[model samples]
Target: MQETERLAEVRERIARAARVARRDLADVTLIAVSKTHAAETIVPLIEAGQRVFGENRVQEAEAKWPALAERYEDLQLHLVGQLQSNKAEAAVRLFDAIHSVDRPSLVDALARAIDREGRSPTLFVQVNIGDEPQKGGCAVAALPGLLDQARGAGLTIAGLMCVPPAGVEAAPYFALLAKLARDQGVPLLSMGMSDDFETAVTLGATHVRVGSALFGARA
Candidate 1:
């Protein structure tokens, strides 16, 4: 399928999922993950009216977004990968939202960066929902503390983000993330990906990051 065709399909799927959940379609934001893809591939989607995108690396986004941002109005770039503390300032300046804040040290870095740059991107604290050792999110038990630190540092905590274990059902993890968001007085939830975004939307995901479904398999 063509990129525009795929964009239409994903939007339709999101609308259907929202309708089934009795949620307004406007509540869910679709973020097309553009990491690993070239600008030539991304521009077509932009021209097709896709405004929100997610990238995995600061350097990669820096290389492409500056020029793209100049041409496109209201383009929202998001950092959806694990962020290194050293890159906090660059991430703050470039992304409109960040989905991988998980530790106190990183929070401190972001706070300082925001102060210096005078720009605050929407922030989500990623949780190790499945307790995967190799993952980059904060442990479940450490959530409260991490949140406190983020809030204390004057960061606007948008909500929580999580990546469920691959090749398994993602509903439970999405549900748990929702519950955690509620418990912590957060109003947004960023969860879901190419394979399970519909499920994520049904379970109260306010944002879904979809890549392969829209861009085709990455090389």
Candidate 2:
């Protein structure tokens, strides 16, 4: 399928999902994950009114930012992949929202970078809802305290983020994230992806990150 067609299909799917969940499509922002894809592939989506784009690597985002941001001044860049502390400065300068903040050290690094760069991006604390040690997220048990610390460090705590275990139903994990967000009094729930985002929406995800479903399989 063509990229424009794929983008439309993905937008339609998100609208349908929102309708099924009884939400206005506008409430559910579709973040097109642009990791590994080049500027050529993403520009078409931008032309089609896809304002929000996600990138995983700081270096890749840096390479793409100068060119893209120059053309689309209102573009909202999101760091949806796991971020390293060393790349915090680049991240703060480029990304408008960060999805993977698993470690407190990285959070502090982000705070310093944001201060140095004079940027304020919404921050999400990544929680390993499935408790997979291999994954880069804080355990569910540690969320409240970590959130408190993040708030104290002058970061605007937007909400919680998580990627559930593959092959298992994602709704429970989504529910857990939503409840945790509510418990913390945070409003946004950044769960869901291309495959199981509808489930995530039903469970109260305010924002859904979808790439493959939108742009077709990434090369």
Candidate 3:
């Protein structure tokens, strides 16, 4: 299917999911994960009225978004990948929301960066919901402390984000992340991807990051 067709299908899916969950469609924001695709590949989606997009890296986003933003109106970019402490400032300046803040050092770096740049991107504390040792999220037990650190450093905590263990049911992880968000008194939940976004929306995810479902598989 073409990009526009894929986008319509995904939006319909999201709307259906939202209706089934009795949630307003407007409450859910679809973030087109345009990480690997080039500007030419992305323009069609933009023209199709996709205003929100997510990129995985600060450098890649820097290379493309400046020109794209100049031509587009009301475009919102999010950083949906693990962020490095050294790139905090660049990420802040580039992304409207960041989905991978999981450490105190990162919090400090982001705080310093925000102060210097005078721009604050909405932040989400990523939790290692499955407790996978190799994942970049912070441990579940450390959530409260990390949240406190982020807040104390003057970073606005928007909500929580997580990518569940691959090849397993994602509902439970989405539910857990929702609970964590509620317990922390945060409002947004940035869970779900192309494969499990419907489940995530049903479980209270306000943001869903979808890539291949819209862009087709990456080469």
lDDT of each: 0.96, 0.87, 0.95
Off by over 4 Å in 2: none
Cα lDDT of model 3 by residue, 15-80, tens digit: 999999999999999999998899999999999999999999999999999999999999999999
Residue-wise C-alpha lDDT for candidate 2, range 45-136, written one tens digit per residue? 88988898888888999998778998887999989989999999988888899989888899899989989999888888899999998888
Report clashes for each candidate as comma-separated counts: 0, 0, 0
Q: In model 2, what is the error at residue 126, expressed in angstroms?
A: 0.6
Which wins on TM-score, candidate 1 or candidate 2?
1
Evaluate model 2: give its lDDT.
0.87
Between candidates 2 and 3, name the one with more favorable lDDT: 3
| TM-score for candidate 1 | 0.99
Identify the superior model by lDDT, candidate 1 or candidate 3.
1
What is candidate 1's CA lDDT for residue 37? Answer: 95
State the lDDT of candidate 1 residue by residue for 25-61, as single tens digits: 9999999999999999998899999999999999999
Candidate 3: regions farther than 4 A off: none
The deviation in Å at residue 213 for candidate 2 is 1.0
Model 3 is weakest, by summed lDDT over 10 consecutive residues, at 147-156
Clashing pairs in 2: none
